[model samples]
Target chain A: MIVGERKPLDEILEMVKDAKKILIVGCKGCVTVCNAGGTKEVGILAATLRLARLKEDNPIEIDEMTLERQCDPEYIEILEERAANYDIILSMACSIGPQYISEKFPEAIVYPALNTCFMGGAQEHGVWAEFCQACGDCKIHLFGGYCPIARCSKSLLNGPCGGSADGKCEVDKEIDCVWHLIVNKLMKQGKLDQLTQVKPLKNWTTSRDGGPRKIVREDLKI
Target chain B: MKSGSNLEKLLNAGEFVITGECGPPRSADASVVREKAKYLKGYVDSVNVTDNQTSVVRMSSLAGSLILQEEGVEANMQMVCRDRNRIAIQSDVLGATALGIRNMLCLSGDHQKFGDHPEAKNVFDLDSIQLIQTVKMMRDEGKLISGQEMAEGTEPRLFIGAAVNPFADPFEYRVYRLAKKIAAGVDFVQTQCIYNMDKFKEYMKQAHDMGLTEKVHVLAGITPMKSLGMARYMQKSVPGMDVPDEIINRLKGVEKGGQSKEGINILLDQIQILKEIPGVAGVHLMAIEWEERVPEIVEAAGLLPRPTV
Candidate 1:
């Protein structure tokens, strides 16, 4: 799931200060689960903006709408009729939402209200942790079901660097050393030899180093 | 005879070599390197010029190594994966070799969080092991990391060294990490500073049993504690550093003014013990910021008149 957090209210107010008619759009996807950009958050933001504006003697019209999933074009297409009604459209979904909306309605002034953090799931209520780097190659099976590329601070492939102590990372004491966890898990599973085998230099071309990526599925193409 | 470096030659000839460290000054001063090199020039085989050790900005290891070479001292130029990518790393390798640097140490530098610039973005595009293999490829295969061959006789030839930590967590895996580094074409390794002798002995035994010692010369790291505060900070704060309670108690036993002398005595004991340990090839005395005392430490350890091969 794509986790996101709402931009600060002051920044949002500064952004929409010039617009009279503003639409706050929310997503029912991952942002909703993380309590970031759900319908309730959208209502709260709309109310807060209205109060902030009314206090300044400059109250303007504000509208709220929730989409099934802003990342999908089908849901974004529903706003075609009302897209031009507002001077500004503030997307409360992940960054992908505003991108999808702008791609569909090119003339619409679209802005993201939420910062898409990472592709991760809720570790617990109100807490989210990243678990994937989307590096186009997955080696978790060899690492005892942990993703070092996303979890390790150094993204080390061979083994842990000499900075971990008491199972905590040197970068932050609160963060668990992911390699320590991987080594312990592999040791328990009797697969420690997998770590000893020299992992060659990673082909970072599959990662962001290769630049913005795209997929072309001929089988699914019309 | 991969690099025919003095360090390599001494190790290959089965001599217990002594290596010292010279941290580049924070300011852009070549004379500071020259001054530090003066203390370690005749007292040790090669001096390791650190690359922004602990992430504090300093003179680059390349410039420091070049300065050491100009001072008629051999440099084990240290390269870290934190600040540069493969292109810069390869370019620096060529540049350093062109400047007659014969030794290189590959490392995954300390995280930037501990440095002066905590907000700095680290470029760990290649870790220590990968850096070792990359340099080895450039030196031996005459190929760049991109698999493109360099023109004839232009490849960098360097005696590659890597670091190992015997005190880091998952303690049993540290020896295996050394094996992996050796498999990656590292010719030798200098371990993290050793204070917990029991743990280091166990690590050495494992390496010896695995025949990793035969494959790579293992240089045990030695840092003489300057004060009780330094020992306490290393024990409680520094990761991967195992400063035992016994060591701290020993430091506590000494007067504040005498701790440095006590520290040297402790280092002498460790060096004597390290020499007898199987698979231990030499001692890499860090003596951080205490370069003036390196000659005294080397002499006390009976490593003077360093072998000239």
Candidate 2:
């Protein structure tokens, strides 16, 4: 899931501090899974904001709506007519949704209520950990399913550094050594011999280092 | 008994005790939380650490509770059944008790559909009523839900609590539901954010008639609205919340130039009215980002401290 977190309450309060009419928009996609921006959060934020406003006696008109997927243009279309009802839109979706709103409604101010974190998976109930960097490449097949690009502090490909000790990352004892996990997985599969083949330096051209990238299939295009 | 235990004793002594909520920071930083805690420490009897509140990922409530405890403030660890099953919930309760967290607010929780985790599977193997029963069973029977004896012959105990929204659809039914929760072993009940004191009083009268007043502690939840737009959004969007037209009109009546301060004053007024309601045990202030303003509202409500306690 696209793991993210709500921005600090004070920051969010400031973002919508001046608006007379506000709409809290929630997304039901990746952000919902990570618990950053979704319908329930939108409700709580709306309540909290109301409480804050009530305390001040400067009551504002705040409403909430949730989109099936804010990042998708199709779902965002649902917000079109409703968008004009409020002066400001407080999107509880990931960063993408707010930008999409801004793009679609140039006149209406769009504000993000969540801090987009990173691509990760649920490690356990209520725990999400970063597991993918979306480097525009996939090498998990060679590394036994763990992405060093995301988990490794240095994104090392060949093996663990000399600092790896007791099967833990030396940089932080709390962090598991991803290379060690890779080695263990490879050993279990009798693919340890692959470790002898030194891997080349990763190419940064295809990733964010080379600016925005895109993928297009002629057959899939209109 | 520890000082914390003594505090619990005071709470049980029929004093007009106050409680509030403190949502942990979304980031790894604890400085902001500490600052807010410092402001709230002596004002309220206990502070609730909301668990992934509203299904938004936050710093663990366990860690937040420990921080409050270390700072010499009583902490109420809220545990929701929406995210975990019986085993995890049981272990977490036991762990919290070991860490000196004596108060617990059990909730069935708003569905993941309501939270930021709609796609996330919910674990409602036990509802709020069942969880309360489990806690009572553990404390009284020293056994799990399966009837197996707890390890080491030790069981967790807590000042069990729950939430009720008197403004929910079929309002009277919401009050009846509270009766059920109280009957199932809820020691205290903190209501959803209350915008209308009159409505709350009416609900309290019903609760009193039902004889729930003698059994369960009732804390009225109060939050100061920040702006006019916010008030409208809350009434329209917040499920199980009712923001009366008068309050909205009063807010809208304020001059545009002085809205925020006016809103705060209005909230303070509501708190004052809530304090006077005969059946109200106390108030649960949910300031959200305005945690710094809680002391002012409490003092304004004329509830600084009990001379007898």
Candidate 3:
């Protein structure tokens, strides 16, 4: 799932400094799963912003709402009736939620309350490790379920980059070296020889490098 | 024959070309570059001018390389994709080549987080391997990476080079990565700091098996440890470098003030073994912050009287 964290209180306060009636929107998608922008987060943001405004002697109204998957047009259309009643929309979801709301309500000012981070799932309770770069191509099988393109510091397809000492990366000693993890996993499975084959230069055409990508599925189009 | 440069000619002539590095000072001083160049003068075939090495701001590698050129030492302009986009990189290539910078080594660079400008945005629009391919396109094809022709005689001729680290992880693939570098159109290869001789010998053996030595000049990189503290730092803290415990114990066995001498001897032994390796085309001695010791290391390593074109 996509991971994100709440924006700084100062920055969030500054965004709605001039606004009167604002829509505090949340998403039931990845942001909800990550506890970033969910129904509970929406209430917290609404109460916090209102308290801040009340303390400033300029009290503001915040109408809190949560939508099912803020990225989809059908889900976004559900907010059409109440969206026009606000001066701006303060989205607590990932970046995609705010952009979608803004596009649906073209005249309404939209702002994100969370900084969208990476595509990852929770490791423990609060820990999340990135496992994919969305390089648009999936080749995790080559590295025993690890994605070196996203995890390695250099995105080195044929990497480890002489920076792997023990099990840590050169960039930060605290961070585990992804190649080290990959090698250990492969070695455990008795597939260590697979690492000998060098990875070719990645074809960036499938990635964000080739420009905004789109997928069309003929089978599911209808 | 890309630039008919001294380094190119020496490597082509099959002479064991020795190279040295001169990291530009943080301040806007060309004299520091010249100061380091003077130490390497007549000791190395070409001097590598580092580009904001470790992501710290420094005098530009191009400007520093030009200073080396003025000091009568050939320059290998090092470029990293961390600071500039393709436009600025391409522009610098043409500018550096016009100023007589002949050798170019492409690197991905240490991440900016390691430097003072941790907040600065990185422009890794292309990685080191892609940059190598882009430079090759501009030189060999006389065109841009987009396949557009140069306006006239503006193609930048460079003896392309790239760096590889055998001491990283997944050790089996290190040699294959060198082969990939050769396939990326690199004319030469420099390695990361080598302390584990047994691993390096095995790496060289695989490189030779793949015939990489015949296709490109593989200069084994060696950084002489200054102390046990430095060795420990590189072993535990530094990335990709695995200093064997015996080397550290050897340094520790030396008297308190005599560690540096023992360190130099260890490096000298490594260089001697590196020379006997079948595929080693040269040695790149990176005496970081200890530039004054370069002449001594080269003299002891028998790399003096640097080859002329």
Candidate 4:
């Protein structure tokens, strides 16, 4: 899932300082599950902004609304009624929300209130760790289901690069050396011989190195 | 005579070769390299110029190797994958070759988090093993990584090397990693500094059993521990360095200033043991910043008067 976090209040306030009225829009997508941008969060932000503006003696008007999903055009159309009435539209969703809103309402000023982080899942109640780089091609089955491209610091295909100590990465003691885990997992599965053949150089064109990617499903189109 | 490098030639002739290392200065100082080369010029076979070792920015190893070569010293220039894409790496290989560098060591460079520029984005487009294969492709197959042929005879014929660590975790897999490197077309390998001799021996025995030693020359790495603090720092902080308790105890037994001598003594003993080990080709003596002590270490180890290939 796409994880996000709220931007610092000062920066958000600075972004909206020139506007007398703004709309705070939230998304019911990945940001909701991560507790970053949900309906409740939008309500809380609206109240805080109202209080802050009231204390400044240049009080401003604020409106709050949460959409089904900010990424889809169908859900974004819900803002067509009141979007033009405000000086600025503050999106509390992932970065995509502001982009989509801006694209749809070209004349309206759009601002992202949250920073989009990464595509990862929750590790604990308050902790989230990255697990995927979305390299577009997957080869996890080769290394006992561990993704070296996403997990290893060096993204070494044939690794445990001279820096694996006590199953931890040399980059950080807190992170596990994914290669070490791959080796041990393969060893336990009696597949240690699989690593003998030299893995060839990776074709990184499928990764972000190739630039912004797009996927078109011809079969499902219109 | 693959690359006709002094190190490759010495190893091919079955002479127990000795190579030294020099980290390029953090600034653009050619004299620093020349001054260090003077200390190691007659003491070893070829000097290995490190490429931003520990991720601290320095004068490029390409420039450093050229500088060392200007001082009448052969250079084994190191290249890492962390900073260059395959395009840049291949381009640099050609550039280094055109400038008369005959040897190159492929490494997955130290992560940038440990470097002076922690926020820098790393480009590990190819790991060390793939890097070895890429260099070999250019050298033996006379083609670039894209499988496109360059103008005839423009290929970079480098004596490629890689690094291994016998003391890292999942201990049983280290030997297989070495085997993969050998299969990837590495001509030789230099290991992490050996402090845990017992573990290194076991790792070497596994290589010998797998018949990996015959395919590639293995140069055992050693660094003289100058002080107890250095030893402790390596043991605790530096990953993959296996400093045994006995070594620490031995260092502890020494007086404040005598630790350096004790460290050299320990290195001398390691050199002797490394010579007798089957399939061991040479020693890559990395006297980190203490280049002056390399002459004494080589002399005491009876490896002086390096062979004239």
What is the TM-score of each predicted model, taking all chains together?
0.96, 0.56, 0.84, 0.97
> Which regions of candidate 3 fall more than 4 Å away from where they truly are?
A8-23, A44-63, A72-89, A100-111, A123-125, A131-149, A166-168, A173-222, B150-155
Give lDDT: candidate 2, residue A222: 75
lDDT of each: 0.91, 0.77, 0.86, 0.91
lDDT of 1 by residue, B35-89 (tens): 9988998999999999999899999999999899899889999999999998999
lDDT (tens digit, per residue) of candidate 3 on A1-222: 999999998999999999999999999999888999999999999999999999999999989999989888899998878888988899988898889889889988999999999999898887887878898989999988889878877676555566667778877877778878887787788875576554544667898879998989999975
lDDT by residue (tens digit), candidate 2, B164-277: 877654453456567667767778888889997778889998988878888887888888888888889988766557799987898899877677777788887877787777
For each candidate, report its DockQ versus the true two-chain complex: 0.78, 0.01, 0.38, 0.85
Q: What is the C-alpha local distance difference test score of candidate 2?
A: 0.77
- Please, what are the lDDT tens digits per residue for candidate 1 over residues A1-222? 888999998999988999999999999998899999999999999999999999999997899999999988889999999999998999999999999998899999999999889998887788888899999988898889999888988888876999888899888887789999999998889987898887877788888889999999999988
DockQ for candidate 1, C-alpha atoms? 0.78
Task: Please state the Cα-based DockQ of model 4 relative to the true two-chain complex.
Answer: 0.85
lDDT of candidate 4 over A1-222, digit per residue (tens): 999999988998999999999999999999999998999999988888888888998788888888999999999998888889999999988998999999999999999999999888898997887788899889899989988988899888889888878899989988889998899998989997778777877887888789999999999989
Which residue pairs in candidate 3 have backbone atoms (N, alpha carbon, C) closer than 3 angstroms, thus clashing? A162-B168, A162-B240, A163-B239, A163-B240
Worst 10 residues of 4 chain A by lDDT: A192-201
* Residue A78 lDDT (model 1): 93
DockQ of 3: 0.38
True C-alpha contacts between chains kept, each model in order: 0.75, 0.00, 0.44, 0.86
Write out the backbone clash pairs for model 4.
none
Candidate 4: tens digits of C-alpha lDDT, residues B110-137: 9999999999999998999999999999
